[model samples]
Target: MDLHIVDLIESLNNFDENPSARLSNSIIISDYPGLISYLIQNLSGINIKILRQLLEYIPEQILEEILINETLPSKLIEHIKTQPPDYDSIKILSDIYDESIYEQLVDSEVLSKLVYSIQGAGPKMCENLVKVLVFISKHKMQEILSIPNSRNFGEILIYRLNRAQGIEKKLMLKTVTDIIFSFPDYFYINDLKVVCDIVVDSLSNQEEEILTENYEALTALMDVKDFFDLKYRFSEIYEVLQVPEGNSYILKIQDRIYSMISN
Candidate 1:
């Protein structure tokens, strides 16, 4: 083990033992400028708890500088492809606010790997991966949309949404809505119909948060008028909307859908 890593481990252990020592230990750890790069390089071997602590304590500006200067995003993507995907490392990467990191990820074609990973990921891991994709889509929609089989990625999200429950389902619904809003023209007709179906089915959900997300998703889908024809599912949507009576927002969404169909 490298001396710096050994020292970092010791510092983390001390911090863990005496939570009050956090400030001083964090300062000591931050002095080692290459710490972030070294951690990324040895992500597979490092303890996830230690990694999370180091990342959390490191100042954002310093972390950003190290990430940009070290070209760590490329290395992280390489690790994802070549090794067992490290959820903690990927989670760390996802939490980063740097646009350059995401740009490199997209340039290196990381989206496909991420989308593929979702199929096998555990629920928490799946949510983290989807959150990363949501971040990338927000920053680089055109690049993500330009990738081959991008629509397939959207379909996978819809598939996940159908099976997901609780917070996982809500996140997927929000992700789908954001994607539709960002690139409404990118989805194929079949995928758009499936998304609409998901939204319509979700209308009967009693959870206010889920219902709000479903409304936003439906609104986004309405933008893709060329592909999404609400008429086919009007009866289903109307029936579902009836289950949630007296809610003004749901009532408004119901009214909007009715107007769209009538026009």
Candidate 2:
């Protein structure tokens, strides 16, 4: 074994022996740039549990530096692929603002794994996975749209939308909105219509926050170039907003849609 590897392992072991020593250990690691580099470079050899612990104490700026390592993004994807979803790792990856990490993710075909993992995921995992998807869609829309299975991925998003609720559903809606705005041509007519239907259906939701998201999602859909052809799909919106006295909030949303389509 390399002497440096042996020394790192020993030091990690010592940190494990005294859990409360994390503050001092993090300080020592941060003061030595070489040690931080060595740790990041040899991440594959280190135990995940230990790495997760060490990450907690690392300063945010230093952690951002560590995240920029080209290998780290791929490694995080591989870890999610080979093991059950690691919320911490996924959350970290989602928080990464580096375009290089997103490029690595695109090259690795991380989308399919992320979508597949959404099934049967707990709330936190689902939130992180969707956040990552949203991030990729925002930064690498063209690459994602060019993938052969991109349409299938869209279908999965719609399917999940049908089954999701509350915040998950809202996030899913935002992700779908982002993709549609970026690649309106990619979705078939029926897909576009279904998205319209989903948004209109969500208007009945009583939660004020969800109702607001539904309104925003609806307005976003109307902005899609393709949505004009499918505007009839939202014919039901008029019926939904109709009231004896007319609720002010619902009326406002109705007015916005009418104003958007008329312009």
Candidate 3:
């Protein structure tokens, strides 16, 4: 016998909880494409939010269909958006963080849109996006950066490296930029200078990660001609590193630069 979505509507309506109703309704919708398609065509007849929440996953076509459902009441539609920002905006810092960064984590779909936004957006836009990604983690950050057009993720990050001002986030930026270099076509001259500068500066800060990352950056820079220019621009940095209060790590870098450029 051909099944029907409406036939299960009565039972679906009987449940107050989301999970059971979702499981039951899924069984019905999957059983009858014709009736499900017909109900989808007449979306005004049911609560799209509940339908969306009940579905195991929202298909792109189905979401597109739902978006076009103009007959969906504004109040009910607003309720669908009742979900709040993932972070409490009341506790946010105006200068240190971006408001849009908090919106990126609403769900995976929002996060995906955010990653795409970073690709085409300018440095400021990518700045907030990277902050959000790092707030998430190296693994989640990789997921966003791995998507096509994600090479630009480093652009904002490198911009941060140059402007970073002896703060914890600034210090952490060394590792973040290093991660960005993993991209096949990234690590441009401007980016390299900013990263190398941060790496060298970390010598005073005495961060082992910074020293290690700087070595790798120098190795990477050996291949790029503009790296020689970066050395000239950063000439004063080696002098600071050479003073050696308690930082042989940084002094070592100064010696290496002297050796490389002197020869």
Candidate 4:
């Protein structure tokens, strides 16, 4: 039988909470083309969870189709930048694979709005938002970093990194790593110096996960030849790791960086 999304949507509206999941499942399992665009264009004030569920059903080609519209990026960004930043919807959106849509994201000031949302978010919600930002950077680092406010982008991320704790802090460090390595030419030397400082502090975290991530990030930053120009900071970083009888893992990180810088 031929299926229509509007009919499915109406069926969804008529159902009470109990059966909605079943109906949503039916729609998703079908994987019809144009379904995602239909939802975006026709739906208004839809619950973000429902929207995410629907978006998750969409294949990547359909997602690219939805973004082909000039207006959709701004609409999607506005939807994501809601009062708390919609984590589920943004998460689904972040998986977008098309490179062309990233230009539209920059035009919509997605980076600026994400930074604003990060400023006030409590820890739980902040991790979700940071994940969305990280995914965007993962996919579109060069395009997003090329924009004029990209330094502000780096600074905002660093500011968050400075105050973040637990898992959120690890996510921020990974985002910083992506930024530092992906667009070294986009950020100024001074901005990188600040990032190096943050990575140095992160390396001192006792958790092995954070330590491993910071070590990898620090290595990437140092691999950039310009980072070596700031040679004076190396001893300070080494000394920070030298807190008498630190973890053996931390010592290994120190030894690795020492090996690199010594050569």
- Please write out the lDDT profile of model 4 over residues 93-207, one tens digit for every residue: 5555344665455444566666565555566455555556665676666665665545655666666677778877787788777766766666567767877777676656545
TM-score of 4: 0.50
In order, what lDDT does every prediction score? 0.65, 0.63, 0.48, 0.61
What are the RMSDs of all candidates, in order? 6.8, 7.3, 14.2, 8.2
Clashing pairs in 2: none
lDDT of 2 by residue, 23-100 (tens): 354445334345455555655534444445455554453565566566666676677667666766676666563565
Judge candidate 2 at residue 118 and give its lDDT.
69
Mind giving the per-residue lDDT tens digits that candidate 3 earns over 1-263?
23455665444445454454365445533443443344445443243323543442434324344334433333222232353221211111112222344334344554455556565565544555566555544445556665665555566667665665545344346446446445424556666666666666666566554455555555455445556655544555444443336777655755676677656
Candidate 3 lDDT score relative to the true structure: 0.48
The estimated TM-scores of all candidates read 0.57, 0.52, 0.43, 0.50
lDDT of 4 at 68: 61
User: TM-score rank, highest first?
Assistant: 1, 2, 4, 3
Tens digits of lDDT, candidate 1, 1-263: 56865676666655562343463445554455556555655655354445555555654534564556465666666666776656766777666635655565564446667766766578767666766776676666666567675655566566677787887688778877887787777667777788877777666655666887887777677667775554558667656654266688767876886676557
Segments in model 1 whose C-alpha atoms lie over 4 Å from true places: 1-41, 44-128, 226-230, 242-252
Which 10-residue window in model 2 sums to the lowest lDDT? 23-32
**In candidate 4, which residue pairs clash?**
none
Q: By lDDT, is 1 or 4 better?
A: 1
Q: After superposition, how far is residue 207 of candidate 3 from its true place, in Å?
A: 13
